[model samples]
Target chain A: MKKLWWKDKFNIFMAAIAYLTLLFIIAAIGTVIMKGFPHIGKSLATPEIQFAVKLSLYTSLISTVLCIVIAIPVAFVLARVDIPFKSLFNTLLDLPLALPPVVSGVCLLLFFGTTAFGAWLEEIGLPFVFTIKGIIIAQIFVNLPFMIRVMKSTILSVSPRLEFIARTLGCTPTQAFWKITLPLSRNGIIAGTVITWARALGEFGAALMLAGATRFRTETLPISLFLNMSTGDLEEAMAAANLLIIISIISLYIFNKLGGDFIGGTRGV
Target chain B: MIKLADVSITLGDFSLKNVHLEIRKGEFFTILGPTGTGKTVILELIAGLYRPDAGKVLINGADSENIPPEKREIGFVYQDYALFPHLNVYKNIAFGPRLRKMPPSAIKENVQGLADMLEITHLLARFPGTLSGGEQQRVSLARALIMKPKILLMDEPLSALDPNTKRMLCGELKRVHEKYRCTVVHVTHDFNEAAMLADRIGVILKGKVKQVGVPREVFERPRDQEVKNFLGVEPLKAVYAR
Candidate 1:
């Protein structure tokens, strides 16, 4: 059957919007690749750049792992159990996502940098100001919301009846969660972890404010890009930007591959 | 024996008020009610999944207020089976015994025996998602049976099956009940299911037990206007026509 003009018009309009969005992304990324490809050899040879890359990888990995560890229980509680101030808890948890990255970093600095508790922590040898630990702390603070959001939605998709069945079969509440709930939410958990890692990797303003963009000390990939660009070293900055773009594309690809089912809701029994 | 004495609970819009019931040992008790009448709530309460807002639930003449579902030695089968989709049939059946820390050898023996009894030995390697409704139903029964629970609670276990599948499984259910003599409290909206499997039936409407008696008595002679109206709409014999 021949389609109607009006019917095809809506389809064409939607396609136009999608293509326009894609065009913007490709243009933005194409400029960096064209400019940065030639400088890749020199940019990678720098000790400072290498240090930033290594530090970013390790810190993001640690923070992502920590986010998963904390998110599992928090997601389960939010998904399953009832609490007194649940709305309050949800609002507080989501506040980080709403705040600007720089503002969040400033808030973290005030709380953990100059406070008496921060002093006590320093006394115990765990400092969170202008250090690698500060970078990790900031990454976790920024990425935790993504972890919780994905994990909570995934946990909610799994039926509580499965846990009830487990409990009836002589497994405790904790056992039920570990055996049934966790394994069931595996796909979502993986997707969440990848998204959290990607978010942490791309974190910049927070890392700069909290860790202070040092030369070879606490510099991350984004910090490296900024520091290089500040000295009019556009090639190295573009190189760093291209690297970030490549990592992001890879992360996004993995998320899309694993996330179709995660977003579609729970797997069928 | 299983008993609910003055049990009252308010869940969202539904509330059960001063409910009382007595189910004897080895009896197939069916709580007959329409959908959304809190039939599953009663089963959960008996299984210790939900605590009653007021009064006591007594299992074997002991107050079960403090006992958790894990310690209750009960088996619950949901309408949708609630099988672990990640595990194959073998692991799903063996989950309970493994959780109890039983030896590997004993778990294998118990699971194998139950699988044979339920005629699901061929489905042991398949996942629940691949199985037909009837096959999944049998696997669910096997999973619950392997635990050898003191009481088995089924919440519309066969309601999701087709007519033929439902009929076949109902026969299997009767056979299993007769062989094990496990006290079962099966809740359903279908009166024909209650008539076929129940030694006694309790008419529940809006979380209230209107009548409790043998199937014939509950079917032929409802005690109250509400029970009469509920059963009056659909005759018991007509439900078995298909």
Candidate 2:
């Protein structure tokens, strides 16, 4: 069999890189699976673990919803409107993504802990420190950039002509957005939501700093794992870590599938 | 009943400087130009998509600068047929009326009427993505026409179709224009299309209306070198050799 000279070295190198990447990913996944699954069933069934799981799910869902509601308008403005200092707004939106989660937690704590703004918030019965609400705020702050980026691209991908057509068809600007822009961008919206929800679900450092690791109160899964590790209970810590790993895997799988659907559907359009 | 008075626009590098033109009610007017001549900008200006940097756009004798595109009561068909890909043909056609909050029965009747007129009744259940290029164009035209807009603006609507489909749709468009009796501003780079479809042709070169006249007048009698070349006026072989 004759082989082309160009294919000989380059092909083998590319194949080796691909195989190594695949092997690394498989190894990471296998380790998580091996350590996490056995503890998941019992922990998930226990009342304390169940409450933490339930709270995590509930808060993340709410935070995801809130992020979407806030992000869509901001994304639209960023994508379509000629706002002042657009680059600044874009940079600010992406800042959280670049910042370490622990730093973000600290920043949130300073902004909302006993400061003038925090005092005002407290007076209004809306304090955001060491509360369940603080967890949601942290998740929202971290997840907002992901949603905004997704929505901005989605909105950008759609031709402005379609909206113009809608308006010419007698839809008010709001109506055009609701009927045309929203429906056309449904896939991107869902994909963004899933990814944002997953990010919120796995949120650890910010939740730890802002909400604190109070058992059965503000203790999310990551906090539970941290508390277990600090207490020198390796089995419980490993169990909690394993449970989180399982959830992350399941959520990631769904996100990948849905994200593909969103991207593929829009491309065909 | 659409008039533009000294409309000037600067869209990045291409600029329309002091452009003036008018389309009377029930007339099929075409803007014939080369690519990047800002012909579509004229239609968009009239449709209120872009506010002119200078001058006025009048719809039915009213200054329409403040009017939104949706409120302009004009229907536009883009070059790519910009149909809502998520919507089926029936819904796409019904969009305008539904936005207007016309009764469901009226919307259905109007959609069916336009669908029947365009011979796209069978494809009404299919999404725009599933439709052929010709089918998508027809559906786009139907969607625009069903609104019964005061003026219909089409920007190279048939450019995406096959030549045969283009020819066929041209006839259909003429018939539709006749039935509706609406003023039309059609932008196309194809001289043949302009000649076939225009009641009056406005020749735009580099964003300015170089000349405006009937098809025969613009084509047969070349006023300038640019207009002559645009009309494909090849000098006789002997004259060229000379």
Candidate 3:
């Protein structure tokens, strides 16, 4: 018989702890499915739950596209150039990520509700307070920092020497970016897009604060779940919660497959 | 013709001060220096990649202050062979001509010609990541030469290759310069490279061009004590010493 060493005992203890955590996770998710599986079909037949699903998909798609369009150049500038107050600017960009989603929602609500600037925006035919557009705005505001953070690291992994070589091949700076840097950053763009879309799809507290919990109007999936649970409609709430759980599981699986293990963007991108 | 008239630049911890040099048309000139002596910086400056804080970079007797790198009509080969990993060898060589909006037939002809010349025609379909170090070196040469720039600047192009590959590429480099007859400015730390390829050599030390002469002259008689010590060949008569 082989003798067990101290390291062997330590390894077994750690492995046991990890397995326990995994077991608890499986139990929690399994119970949610068992409670809600039968009512999901009934919930889907209802118009209110259907509206929530459609609204969530529509708003998240738009916000993800907007974030990508805005994040690329901002990330490029942050990663490539030596701008004034770069560290300070980076910290300011990250503040949204560090703060709670509710705080960002409150900040947005006050700025767009009480100020003359908000009134001016309203006069110009763009109103954001408690509207569907407000949901999209909150999503963008919440997820832009994560998208930019991923993109900046992605841009850093590509060497500037490739762009310099492109210039020698008759490419202007803009042309070089399109031909060289952008092509090299295809994986990073995909990773950034996937993570942003997932976050936007599930944004809850900020959407509730900024877009309001109005049924059939600003009702997203999480909002639908919140409203049904609060009104003591356990069957409808369970169905909505189950739908969210399935989506969350799928998105997380995709993110783990496509994105890096950590938030520092993909390696060798 | 290229000339740097009393050029000086200071960036962060590195500085190049009071550097003056001239290269005649169609001449193969080599700038020889030890590591981190800013030899590559000089090549980049000549290629319009950098601007001197104090003096003008004159290309064909015109001040290069307004010339961006794209419009400078200069080709640069980097030490690391920075071929675009996303582009195959054919597209890599054809990049410049396509940008010029040359007709497809002409672009194909040009790409094939340079690839054939560099002996990389077989690797045209393969991306840069698949190529060996020597193969990448040849592909990079083809990529730059495809532009047909009047001035070709190389920065330690052979440093990354193995010893055997370096010797072979060094001979090919001379042959390519002769065939193209473009004004060549090659930077390297090896004394043997300058001795073999340069019509004239500039020895840079401590951010200055300490001596500019034919290889024989510079090798036989170094400028000062620092250069004499740096070249590492004692000027002594063995019989007299005995």
Candidate 4:
């Protein structure tokens, strides 16, 4: 069969776009490896690097758990409840995503520094400036919007009638949430947690500014990489970058595989 | 008897104004109306899913306004079946009794008994997503009936079924009503279904009860032209003059 001329042009245009996209992605990966891989083995195994990695993983995990525990309920209220000023609540939750990471860090610092509330916290024996706690607080602030947005969409996709049916069947509101709503939205929660954890893990500007990047103390992996690069320790910086890349890729892959089910379940109407 | 005395509610895009209804115990009452006529809203109001803006709902001469849905002693089945996709048929049927803190043995017996009644015993272990439309409908019915509520409100329960399944389920529903002697207020837009199952038929239009009587009375002796047209029994020739 003879092909139409426009069809050939359309195919060529589509091929060009796909090719460029793949090329861009490959270029990014090549650049990271070329600049970072040579020092991976020894630097990754070093005690300081190991400590930073462990601390970073643990803190990000904690921050992610805290963010999800708080954000899921907030997202549900935003999506499902008839709270007053609902638009305002949604805008405030999304503000962090729009702000730069350093701006977020500054805002956290001002709120949690030796200001009045921070002083009150200090008096209560809960200081959160230039400490590991500050790092977690910063991560939570930066990653919260992603978790909330994911969870809000997920909860919105569920028909409210299902919960109503459960309620009529004698389940309390809380029981219905746990037994019906939560299980139905499991894929969204999982995808959101993965994305939030990845975001928390790679947090740099906020963690450095708020946590002070002190070696063997408040230094998370991203902060360590920044500190190392600034001090001309190229090998250590490259190793940390490589490790971050590896972790991010694996997390994103799993997120894509599982997140597909969530999006697929809600595709047309 | 469940009675709605001068009930009024203004939901978005729909309103029920001075809507009055009395569903007698052990009677199969069908609320027949076109889409957006507030048939489902009436069921929701009775089930305590929505509070009326005005008037009172009395169940056996007691006000039901303060009672939450779980305590309202009413069972509701939605048009979409609303089966818990996460739960298998058995768990879905067992949910109400479990929530009531019934003993495990009793819960099992009630669920199995209802499943057997609906001929859904083979599908108990399967999740709702795995069941056919007819199977899901039966499972939903079983779940609602296992609660043994004071009354049952079904919102267009057979609207989603294929014609053959709908016919079969209509017969099965009649049998179920006879066996349990449970009062049923079934909502449907189909005139044939109303004629087949309802002891009394109420035609709702624009949120008002235009007519309520036995099915033959509403069909053969409609009080208004709207009810006659709605029942699809009007002559094909035009009756209006400009």
Candidate 5:
């Protein structure tokens, strides 16, 4: 072989940089598993830890379902209809994705904890402050924008020409959407659902602020980890971190099984 | 019968300015034009897909402005056929009838009868993505015709096919029209296709109809230089005798 030139050496350096990041991630995850995997059995048997796991699953599942039900119509409107101030509305919708989770939680608190609307909601016996309902609301708030982003791209991939043709076939606008647009968006919807569920499961700062760190009451996985770390309980903290990592891996595996367009709903008809 | 009187629409950079036409009942009227001249917009206007900015569209002595496309009862055949990819050919043809809540037995009868007539009975089980261009067009026809639309609008329906398929489908189109006996408003750029199929032809240039009459009259007696340029005809002479 000829002598390696500077360009070839630089390319090798780039590959090494990629491998370095990959290695860093693997080592970090390895540390977590090595420290926590053995204690997982005992930690999970704790009543508070069991409640945290149940609450995380329960809230994320409900939020994922609500996100999908709301995202379909919202994405269709953004993709197809020409609403005035659409760009402004879109920016507002995407605000949750850009802002810190704590700031969003603060905003939610100001609206639902102290304002007239909060008073009205409390009067109706439907409160969302320092309760399990507050945790579900926080999860939905954090993940709905992402679900809509994925779903909107998927809807955009479907041709408006198909809907135009359906109109001439004696179907109303709503009927056309039901028959044509929704079916073509099946892959995108599945992808959005998976990603939303994963993100909701890992929700932290908003839940911590809004739902409070009450044990056996509103503790989700991330909140459980935070509360356990605060009290210097290494075993419980490690257990929480390991469980989250395993869940993230499972979510990624399901995405791999689904093949392409798992994140953006970009499949076309 | 259908008519567009002083119809105008401004969409972004292109505009149809004061266009007019009168398509009689059961007549095959073809609007011939060059590309990018808004030929498709006229067909869409009549189909109620696009509303005119400042004119009246009368359908059989009724003002059709307030009617939406679903209520217009006009069938549109896109250039690319616009078949639903998820549904197989059988369900695609049965879609309109299903929307009407027709019984399964009647839907099967109509779908199978139309499929046999279109020579696509064997392809019913296949999805649209697997079929060739000609087959997709034929299925599109069966789908639209099953609704029994009284006014059919076609926008370059044969433009996407190969030359041989185009010629064959042109014949099939005429046969379908005769069997249906509906008013047809076909927009195309091919002079041969218009001459072969149209009872009367309209020449559109720069968003206006320059001439509308019999094909022989419009061809032999050119309206102006623009119309002649659009025709782009040349005489063939035999130089060598065999």
Candidate 6:
């Protein structure tokens, strides 16, 4: 079919914006790659760099697991249950996302610094003050909302009638959830897990304030990048940045390959 | 026997008024209504999916309030054939029996028997997404029937099929009913479908059951002018003459 001139103009306008956005992203990534690709292997030779990579991976993995454990039930409740003050709870769940990372870190620090709950946690031998454990806590605090939002939307997209059908076919509520809803929303959950892991991997301000970038102790990839750059170690800093970018790209690739639609303002599962 | 003793429920804009219905065991009872008449609500309430705001739903003379749908031994088939897309047809049909902890041999026999009956034996390995609408409906019917529910509730199960498929499935439904004699409450807006299958009809309009009688009585001798108009029939006097 032949297209009209105005339609062609509109198409060109949209394409131009899209290409401009793509060019900006590519240029930024290319700048980092050109500088850091040569130093990536060399930077790994430093024990601090090794510790940062290992710490980031371990904490992010642990936080993602924790997020999934909490998000499943929370997402299900948000999607299905008729709880009192539901909108209030939803707003509170998303409060961390609205706050700056530094503010979130400050809030966590205050709550766990000298409160009764903090004393109890310390007495129970799980002190979350400038420890690897604290790093995980900060990561979880920042990433939990992302996982929950993704999972809740995904579960909502599935008709609750399907669960009702399972119940009628002789399944209890829990049984129906496990056998039907979980499998149906598996891709979305996996996508959420990947996104959460990526976000946690590059978490900087909260991890810096709460965990305190101690060398070989609580330093993560982003914290390591900052610390190295401050010390005039540009190569090490760029290597860390490059590593984070590569991991995020790989995570997104896996997410898309597994049939996970983008979550946020974009269309999603 | 299935009884709704003045069951009523109101959700959002849709409401079911104080409605009473008694469907005898082994009878093919059809609730005929237009869209937005709360027909599906009645079925869900009977299946124990929705708790009625008032009144009682009794199965075999016992209140089924505390009984869950699965424990109530009621099977429900939705309009869209809600087969679990993650499972193949064989697994879908076997789901109920597996939940009941039937032995492997028994589950295999039951699934195979239903597959043969529905003539979906060759389609067992296929997923629901691959099957035609008619095939999915047959599989859904088999899934519900394999549980051997004391009462089966179907909500416009054939509405999505083509006319030819609908006719074929209607015959299959009748044959299945005649053989099993398990009580059936089928909901549909199509009077012709009700006429072909229902042992008795309950005409529901605006959340209330206006008439309950055999098809001939309801169609030929509508209680009032409203029913006559809703049914889109000639005047009652002319219907009687024909």
Candidate that would win on DockQ: 1
**Each candidate's chain A: what TM-score?**
0.92, 0.89, 0.92, 0.90, 0.92, 0.92
Per-residue alpha-carbon lDDT of model 3 for A37-59, expressed as tens digits? 98899989899989999999999
Q: How accurate is candidate 1 locally (lDDT)?
A: 0.88
How does model 1 score on DockQ? 0.87
Once fitted onto the true fold, the runs of candidate 2 whose alpha carbons sit more than 4 angstroms away are A1-10, A260-269, B234-242
TM-score per model over all chains: 0.95, 0.93, 0.93, 0.94, 0.93, 0.95
Give a tens-digit lDDT track for model 5, residues A190-224.
76788679889899988777888888888898899
Tens-digit lDDT track of model 4 for A86-147: 99888988898889999988988888884899989978987788988889989999988878
Give the per-residue lDDT digits (tens) of candidate 6, residues A106-171.
Answer: 888877876999879989998888888989999999889878888898888778988998998889
Docking class of 5: high
Candidate 6 is graded, for docking, as high
Stretch of 10 with least lDDT, candidate 5 chain A: A260-269
- For candidate 4, give the docking quality class from DockQ: medium
The 10 consecutive residues of candidate 2 chain B with the worst lDDT sum are: B233-242
Can you tell me which runs of candidate 5 are displaced by over 4 Å?
A1-7, A253-269, B235-242
* Residue-level lDDT tens digits of model 1 in A22-128: 99989989999999988888988888778878998999999999999998889888888898899899999989988899998998898888899999998899998
**DockQ comparison, 3 vs 4, better candidate:** 4
Among residues 3 or more apart in sequence or in different chains, the pairs in candidate 1 whose N, CA or C atoms overlap within 3 Å are: none
- Cα displacement (angstroms), candidate 3, residue A72, comes to 0.6
Estimate, for each residue in B41-158, the C-alpha lDDT of model 3 and write its tens digit. Answer: 8998987778999998999999998898998888888888998888888888888889999999999998888888778889999999999999999988988888888999999998
Q: Score the docking of each candidate (DockQ).
A: 0.87, 0.83, 0.76, 0.79, 0.81, 0.85
Looking at model 5, residue B117 earns an lDDT score of 89
Query: Which RMSD values do the candidates have, in order?
Result: 2.9, 4.0, 3.8, 4.2, 3.6, 2.6
Chain A TM-score for predicted structure 1:
0.92
lDDT of 6 by residue, B1-242 (tens): 98899988999988999999999999999999898999999999998888999999999999999998778888888899999999999999999989889999999998999889889999999999999999999999999999888799999999999999998999899999998899999999987788788889999999999999987788888888778878886433422332
Query: What is the per-residue lDDT of model 5 for residues B107-224, given as tens digits with 9 covering 90 to 100?
Result: 9999999999889999999999999999999999899999999999898989889999998998899899999999999999988788778889999999999999977777776699
